[model samples]
Target: MNQLERLRKYTTVVVDSGDIECITRYKPQDATTNPTLILKSVLSKKYDFIVNNAVQYAKKMGGSISQKIQNASDMVSVGFGAEILKYIPGYISTEIDARLSFNTEQCIQKSIKLIDLYRIHGVDVSRVLIKLAATWECIQAAYQLNKLGILCNLTLLFSFAQARACAEANVFLISPFVGRIYDWYKKFCLDSSYDAVTDPGVLAVKKIFKYYKKHMYQTIIMGASFRRIEQILELSGCDRITISPDLLEQLKTQNFSFARKLDATKIVTVVDQPIPLSESEFRFLHNQDAMAVEKLSEGIRQFSCDQIKLEKFLLHTL
Candidate 1:
C-alpha cells in the first residue's frame, strides 16, 4: 500500500480543501474548509454556479446590503460544504465567521444559521461540524451548542488549555494545529531543521493526546495544519488528521513503512487528580504559551482578512 493507504489504516485522513475536484480525487473521509480556502476556491471560478446560487439565495432573503453580504458568504460556505458532502461520506467542517470568535452569542447564532443552511440544502445537519476558533467564548458557545446536539470542531487550538477546555465543554472535536506551532518555534528559536519525533508541533499533539486518553476524555483529537508528510506520519494514529491536498498527493504517490504512533489503548498513565480549568485558569495557562497566543491571534486575523475579502468578492458578484 502507498503511504496514504497505509496511513488510513490508523487515522481517518481528512482533506483540508474547498476545491471539490481535489476532494473527489483524494476521497478523504472528511473535508475541512476555512475562509482562505473558500476564497481560493471561489476565486478559481470553477464553482461559479455555487457562488451564483448563494447570491440568489441571499438576494431573495431581502435584507440590507451588509446583512445580504453576510448571508451570501454563509451560503457560499454551506454551498461548498453541501457539495463536498456529496463526495465524502463522513463530515464537512464549515467555519463560523472569525470576527465572531470572541463573541459567544454571535458565534452560537452563526453556527445555527450555518446548520440551518445545510439542512435547506438537503445535507444532513449531523454531518456538519461547525468550525470555530478556540477562544474561551467559542468554547463556551460549543458547550451550549453541544447540549443542543450541534457538533463542533474547535479550530486554531494551540495549547493544552484550549484542548482541555474543549473536552470539558463536551466539544465533539478539537483541531490542534501542528504546522503553525512549528512555524512559531522555528522562527522564535531560529531553527528550521527538526525530524518528526523532535518536531515541536508533533510533540504538542502527542502531549494532548496522552492527556486526553489518560483521562478518558471523549473529545476527538484531530491533528491539523501539518507542515510536512513526516508530521502526518508521526501522528498516524490520531483520531483524525486534516491534511492539505498537496501533502495528501505526496502520500498517495510515495511508499513508506507506516506504524501507529498514537494509540489510546496504549495510554496507561493517569493524573492523580485532574480538574477542569476555570475561565481565568484557561486564559492564564493559554497565555503562558507564547506560541499559542501569537498563533491563535494571527490565525484569526488571517482568516478574518480572507473572510472580508470573500465578502467583497460576493458583493462584486451581486
Candidate 2:
C-alpha cells in the first residue's frame, strides 16, 4: 500500500484545500478551508462558475455594497464547501472570518450565518464543523455554539493551554498547527537541526495528544499545518490529520511501511488531576509560551489579510 493508504488505517485523513479537483482526486474523509485557500480557488479559472454564481446571488439579495461583498465572500466559501462535500463522506470545515476572532458575539453570529449558508447549499449542519481561531473569545463562542449543537473546530491552536481550554469547553475538535510550531523553533532555537522525532511541532502535538487521552477528554485532536511527509508519518494515529494537497500527493506516490506512533490504548496510567483552567489562568499560561503567542497572532493576521483579499475579489465581481 502507498503511504497514504497506510496512514489512513491509523488516522482520518483530511484534505486541507478548497480546490474541488484536489479534493476529488484524493477523496479524503474530511476537508478544511480557510480564507487563503478560498481566495486561491476563487482566482482559478476553473472555479469561475462558483464565483459568478456567488456574485449573482449577492446581487439578487440587494444589500448595501459592504453587505453584498460579505454575502458574496461567504457564498464563495460555502460554494466550495458544498462542492467538496459531494466527494467526501465526512465533515467539511468552513472557517469564520478571522477578523471576528476577538469578538465573541460576532464570532457566534458569523458562525450561525456560515451554518445558514451551508444549509442553503443543501448541506446538513451535522456534517459541518464551524472553524474559528482559538482566541479566548472565539473559544467561548464555540462553547456556546456547542450547546446549540453546532460543532466547532478551534483552529490556529498552539499552546497546551489553548488545547485544554478547548477540551474544557467541550469543543468538538482542535487543530494544533504542527508546521508553524516547527518553523518558530527552527528560527529561534540555538540548534535548528532535528529529526522528525525531535521536531518541536511534532513534540507539541504529541504532548497534547497524550494529555488529552490521559485526561480522557473527548475533544478530537487533529494535527494540522504539516511541513513535511515525515511530520505526517510521525503523527500517525492522531485522531485526524489535515494535510495539504501537495503533501497528499507525495504520500499517494510513496510506498512505505507505516506504524501507529500514538495510541490512546497504550497511554501509561498516572495520577493526573485535571485542573479546570479559568480565563485568567488560561491567558497567563498561554502568554508564557512565546512560540504559541507569536504563532497564534501571526496566523490570525495572515488569515485576516487573506480574507480581506477574498472580499476585494468578490467586490470586483459585484
Candidate 3:
C-alpha cells in the first residue's frame, strides 16, 4: 500500500479542499472547508455553477443588500459542502461565518440556518459538521448545538485552554492547527532546533490528545493545518486529521510504513485539575501566550477577509 493507505490504518484522513477532483482522487473519509477554501473554489471554472446558482437564488430573495450578501455567502458555502458530500461518505464541515465567532447567539442561529440549507439540499444532518471558531462564546454555542444533536468542529484552536473548554462543553471535535503553529514558532522563536518530531504545532496537538485520552473526554481531536507530510505522519493515530490535497498527494506517491504515534496506550497526564476556561480565564490564557493570541486573531482576520471577498464575488456575479 502507498503511504496514504498505510497512514489510514491508524488515522482517519480528511480532505481539506473543495476541489472535486482531488476529493475523488484521494478518497478521504471526510472533507472540510471554510471561507478561504470556498472562495478559492468559487473562482475555479469547475465550481462557477455553484457561485452562479447562489447569486441567482439570492437575487430572487426579498432582503436588503447586506442580508442578500449574507444569504448568498451561506448558500455558496452550503452549495460547496453539499457538492463535496456527494463524493465523501463521512461528513463535510461547513463553517459558520467567522464574523459570528464571538457572538454565541448569532453563531447558534447561523449554524442552524446553515444546517437547514444542507437539509434542503437533501443532505443528512449527521453528514454535516458545523465548523466554528474555538472562541469562548463559540465553545458555549457548540455546547448548545451539541445538546440539540448538532455536531460541531471547532477551528482556530491554539491554546490548551481552548481544547479544555471545548472538551468540557461537549463539542464533537476540535481542530488544533499544526502548520500555523509551526509558522509562528519559525518566525518568532530563536530556538531553531524544532523538527517535525518536536514541532511546536505537532507538540500542541499531542499535548491536547494526551490530555483528552487521560481524562477520557469524548470530544474528538482532529489535528489541522499541517505544513508537511512529516507533521501528518507524526500525528498518526489522532482521532482524525484534515489535510490539504497537496500533502495528501505527496503521501499517495511516497511508500512507507506508518507507526501509530498516538493511542490510548500512551495516555498523557495533566499535573493539575481540569483547566477552567471561562471567558475571563480564556482571555487571560490567551494574553499570556503571545503566539496563541496573535495566531488566533490572524486566523479570524484571514477567514473573515475571504468571506468579504466571496460576498463581493457573489454580488458581482449578479
lDDT of each: 0.94, 0.93, 0.89
Write out the backbone clash pairs for model 1. Answer: none
Residue 181 in model 2: shift from native, Å? 0.4
TM-score of each: 0.98, 0.97, 0.96
Instruction: State model 3's lDDT.
Output: 0.89
Clashes of each: 0, 0, 0
Question: How many backbone clashes are present in model 3?
Answer: 0
Tens-digit lDDT track of model 1 for 264-292: 88889665537779999999999999999
For 109-197, candidate 2 gives per-residue lDDT tens digits of 99999899888888898999999999999999999999888999999999989999999899999999999999999999999997999
Better of 1 and 3 by TM-score: 1
Off by over 4 Å in 3: 268-276
What TM-score does candidate 2 reach? Answer: 0.97
Q: Which runs of model 1 end up more than 4 angstroms from their true locations?
A: 269-273
10 residues in a row with least lDDT, candidate 2: 267-276
